[model samples]
Target chain A: DAGVTQSPTHLIKTRGQQVTLRCSPKSGHDTVSWYQQALGQGPQFIFQYYEEEERQRGNFPDRFSGHQFPNYSSELNVNALLLGDSALYLCASSFGNPPSGYTFGSGTRLTVV
Target chain B: QKEVEQDPGPLSVPEGAIVSLNCTYSNSAFQYFMWYRQYSRKGPELLMYTYSSGNKEDGRFTAQVDKSSKYISLFIRDSQPSDSATYLCAMGPSQGGSEKLVFGKGTKLTVNP
Candidate 1:
């Protein structure tokens, strides 16, 4: 089955700009989550969307926001991006609310210059 | 201190060797543990998932969780060059995938052929 798919494999943005990254969950998956991974670090949870509603969130600020669609697709939007925001944005999908194993996409490499 | 602590090891070993990766968490409520593999510029691929304080095995990979100690581990057997990648440990506190996953700084490994 097709796994999670992310768009614009790479991106470059200036400081204070905004960026939107897209993700399509795997077939039959119903939940989507976003994560950020800095260089030499592991993925940090941003938020999770289920049933088109954000069900859970991490410690990140409000600048990092996300939306889930009816088709189970998702979008991660960052506002007023800072250089520190430059990292790999990953989207993962699972089947249920408390999914056991999540499928991940190759992720969007966001570079805030 | 960080919620999850992992040694970001650029661990190197020869092929056909055994590799052990580990992570420790400060949260006792973490109910699910997972290991993910990621190559450069790629999203993390789930390697192993386990709940409870025991061991689970899949092919050449094994995962162990010690809830009492709040430690989790992933072991790769007969490693190959293809196994070379960054290994990340993630945990969820509430009902697994429905909640946010806290991740550790990945451990980079290079299996030399």
Candidate 2:
């Protein structure tokens, strides 16, 4: 079985630009969550998507948004990105019903210059 | 203060040594605890998870949660070089459907051969 997968293992964008990162949840999982990990820091929750709706969000700004498709794949969009946005974006999949263990992707590392 | 706080240690120990990693939280609502290991330039992988205050072990990794004291721990036995990485602690409510995970800053460990 395939684990959680994310697209563009690395990305580079400029300030004020927009970036879109994609994630496919692990098989048999329904919930998708996004996290941001700066260098030498643990991940900070961005938001979670279930049933195509964002359920819970962290303290991030409105520039960060996400979408979950019916197939359980998700996308994270960051608008007006700043240099501070350069970090590793992780996608984790879990079962929402019983809340099982999470499977995380290798993550997309974004570099804003 | 942050909801979850961890010592970001560049802890170096010899192979076969016992290692203890810990996190303390200020949020009493957190009901679920998790430990994640991440290598350099990679996303975190779930190591072990505990529901509440108790000890859970898997192989050489043990997770201990003391909710009453708001402290959690991960211990590695017979540590190996492959175990060198950053360890993260995450927590959320037991219900777990839409609850957000609060993460610590992570501790870095290096197992010297």
Best lDDT among the predictions, by candidate number = 2
| Model 2 misplaced stretches (Cα beyond 4 Å) | B94-98
Off by over 4 Å in 1: B94-98
DockQ numbers for every candidate?
Answer: 0.80, 0.78
Q: After superposition, how far is residue B48 of candidate 1 from its true place, in Å?
A: 0.8
Docking class of 2: medium
What tens digits encode model 1's per-residue C-alpha lDDT throughout B1-113?
Answer: 88899999889999999999999998887888999999888889998888778999999999999999989999999999999999999988644334778889999999999
Error (Å) of candidate 1 at residue B2 is: 1.8
Superposition error at B20 for model 2 (Å)? 0.6
- Please give, for residues A3-113, the per-residue lDDT of candidate 2 as tens digits: 999999999999999999999999999999999999988888899999999988888999999999999999999999999999999999999554767889999999999
RMSD (Cα, Å) of candidate 2? 1.6
Chain B TM-score list for all models:
0.94, 0.95
User: What fraction of the reference structure's interface contacts does model 2 contain?
Assistant: 0.85
Clashes of 2: 0
